[model samples]
Target: MTFTGGNPQEEPPRRVAKKSKKRFLWLALVTLLALIAVVLSVLYDRGEFDGLRRRLLYTKAQKDENGCAQLYRYASDQSGSFASLDGSLVSVSMHQVSVLDETGKTVYEQTVKFQSPALVRGAFRAAAYDVGGTSVYVLTAKGLACQVDTSGEILAVALNKDGYLTVTSNESGCKAAVRVYDASGQPVFAYRSADRFIMTAALSDDSRTLAAVTMGQSSGVFTSYVVFYRINSESALTTTALTGSLIYDLIPMGSRFCAVMEEQLCFLDDSGEVRAAYSCGSDYLRRVDCGDGYAALLLGRYRNGTQHRLVTVDSDGQVMASLDVDGEVLSMSAAGRYIAVLFSDRMVIYDKTLAECARLDAVSEARQVLMRADGSAVLAGSTAASLYLP
Candidate 1:
């Protein structure tokens, strides 16, 4: 004798319908995100997505001795400092910092001056600290720093795409302190190194963590330590000893940090724990760039022979790609999820997945190289800056 309720017969179908609705909603959400991604990619190629342009034009041409049009009339003699800031070309002059738009229009200009109280230190000479935004920060040769507008006196600065700014200033007694600021330039957190000499530091993308490498010497032996701190808090999160090596650079990649040492390349999480590491036993670490969930290392050994290796790793610290490079690597730039290695006579571009994208032969020998995040590049030779968009 079973008594079935009126709605009991409809229960299974109702549950199935609810599950179908949830599945439909999830599919719709995913589809929307996919569409957005596709749109952004398209815009990125068009150069409109990031205030850039679809076409890249060099400066005006002047007739040279060989009757070849010289492009030097528009470029700069100062190629030591160059950066792409908010789709603009930023070059530093000994007297000022100039920003030029994609079409080659000067948008913003800041001049260095011999102001009071330090007239003997000379005017500001800028080398780009970090670009890729509307405004940049420049560190002068005389230990003076500015926010590239009117802000001043920053000893060091670290910024991420999330608009989190971590700036360090020189404190009393050979110490430095860090201050975390929001996008609007409001102070969100402050940290003092207290007694340690802050060597290299970076701010996590989420702005919730700060990683710094500091060193101390005792008994004529130096030991280095990598410390991680929670933002806006007095307590540190973790301290990891970089034993047996000296860290030369600290790079922040998303949520992790890369401690690039003399012969070791190590990745650490926000907790200061090593997740992945690569040690070049006989080779020397030349350069390391970590961004966009990828880390590219340039290792070379010139003592015994000319041996160079380009190694790329993922965020998980797994080696994604490795290649043997020839000759002296003049510079390496990591942007747009791609890595560009510039030799004197040639330059190669590799995509984020560690696949080769394009290789271009140097025309006049690459004195300086710059690349957009998407693999487009400007190779500045002695005469002109050749733009390559691939």
Candidate 2:
């Protein structure tokens, strides 16, 4: 016939070639899908997805003429009762703790009887506790993560970026005690001091090191000691004594710790030794806040009608920037690389170099400012809170 010229072996070779081409196409598609998966994983780890989701879900805050958008209006207008945590607003009243999203949606709410309600926020979590009381509630954006009931009164509480909690309490049989809990509310470490009373404690970001401030008197002189400990060890790793200044707070930044004192800001290494200290010269320290790798201090003269000085210091105690602010400063907040200063007549946002990035005038209702790491700010008013995006 007309097809008799074709060989049977030739037909078999053509079939094999088709099969090989199909296999190659399948392999190429699998490789492309694997690459896409890897890219998504990296983006998720860096919080890109979270940021995108927040932008999409919280689009209700429309900018007004002053670039200020009312993100949430509080149910109660109690001053010093609201905080910002992970793009959400946390309000702690005497009877309830509420967590609201950017669109003013209630994410979580609980009834609590706190004599003095206080909030400590981390990267993605916030802890609501009663100052000098026994109730402590650890929370996340989803809901209440855990509740810790200490054996004694809660003196001070610190939260790391990862939500690890360091609680200092006045426990029985000891002058003070420090307890560390993980983000999941599991107990990680505990220490009780009988010689010196622990004022406050901070857990390192890695959760492997714990640093606590202890107040004691040596030779009839008031002294403060920073005690370092390995969470796995029962003994103190190191102790560094600081004198002449009243230690106000202890904040752990990465591998080191920053001790906020009455007269100076001291940066301590992991061994509890002072790496650098920035002394507030003739100015009196009025307010201070610590961010990722820097500290902002508000210093002013004791006289009226004088401008206040705002200083920013790096983790190595190097002065990064200083700005002279005129007017009455109501509150100051630092987070990430930006600092938010709320004055009587206006609000100013400054970068790490103390350069004014944005300013909004006539903010008389704003009592406090909470700066976010994304250059946005939450202005806490007596009755409502608004978001300012620059």
Candidate 3:
């Protein structure tokens, strides 16, 4: 009765209650949102979520835990030759080499009117060389630049991080010559061989030592040799003979050399002495790749056996792991401690001990694959290129 508007006191209580309810709801909502955010962060750390929101919510593509944020569809059905240098993708097609970054954006592109097959690698930023020809081109911010082409056809080439290069060339049927060059296109050293075919070579980090694997006829029979040279002195350091095998590739690991042979994996020191060796019995070694202080060998069966195997080896020539799969390996790549092997219909990624980290299903047959240091892979299929992040 004392109120002027029938119940001024009652109106204050009702208004107070309503305001209290609104405040409670606001506090509860904030608490719930914060709790949800914390739970999601924990799950992501445990890989339970693998940051799926990054792929689903973000506008720009980013690599998720599944390692899939990039893809490319080739204009042609042909599979291409490629290599990784500086995390850039250098792919070779019919008459062109395309360089792309991790985002699938084409950074640089080059065409060859000469119509010869090409090879590309990430060395000195990026480089592309003609396979089975004499032309070698290195690309930089300036443009497509050619290395000093010497006499004879260029058979093999290797480049270091500092742009130091090693080229193997043959003159007719006589012999092969191995030469090392600095970044300025000046020859560091040249080693000549008579009656020996220099198949391939590798340069060390300091560009001090050059390793070459050559094959020659000894007593009317084929014999392979692992040779080392001191680039500064232009003098031969060591030459070791290998029997009953053919050397296919030479790779540098730290201060040692890994010689990939047909039936064996041999390690040689800087002096070219065989430090360790692993034999494959009758199995034929298909390919050997070194990364993350390890070497991986792709082995085929003996005398037309069906199943194939992959052997993970350490720098000390220790057999760390072996995985046998039932198909021909279409392509393989290794980075850091990860090894990626692609079959016709699927791909498998393994760690240093050859444990299965991930198995990616493929829609079509993959022709080749490129792996990254973070256990991600890019599989080049006939129709498209798929990036697998894990």
Error of 2 at 75 (Å): 2.4
What's the CA error at residue 357 for candidate 1, in Å? 1.7
Clash pairs, candidate 3, are 66-389, 67-389, 85-122
Task: Give residue 336's error in model 2 in angstroms.
Answer: 1.5
Q: Model 2 TM-score?
A: 0.84
- lDDT tens digits, residue span 159-212, model 1: 655655666555554476666766655677766786787765777767788887
lDDT of 3 by residue, 281-374 (tens): 7787777777767898888886565588889887688899988878756788887777888877678988767878788775255678887665
Backbone clashes, each candidate: 2, 0, 3
lDDT of 2: 0.84
Number of the candidate with higher lDDT, 1 or 3: 3
Off by over 4 Å in 1: 1-79, 113-155, 217-221, 304-306, 381-384
Candidate with the greatest TM-score versus the true structure = 2
Each prediction's Cα lDDT score? 0.62, 0.84, 0.72
Q: Write the number of the candidate with greater TM-score, choosing between 1 and 2.
A: 2
lDDT of 3: 0.72
Question: Which residue pairs show backbone clashes in model 2?
Answer: none
Q: Among all windows of ten consecutive residues in candidate 1, which has the lowest summed lDDT?
A: 114-123
**Ten residues in sequence with the least summed lDDT for candidate 3:** 50-59
Q: Tell me which of candidates 1 and 3 scores higher on TM-score.
A: 3
| lDDT at residue 121 of model 3 (Cα atoms) | 48
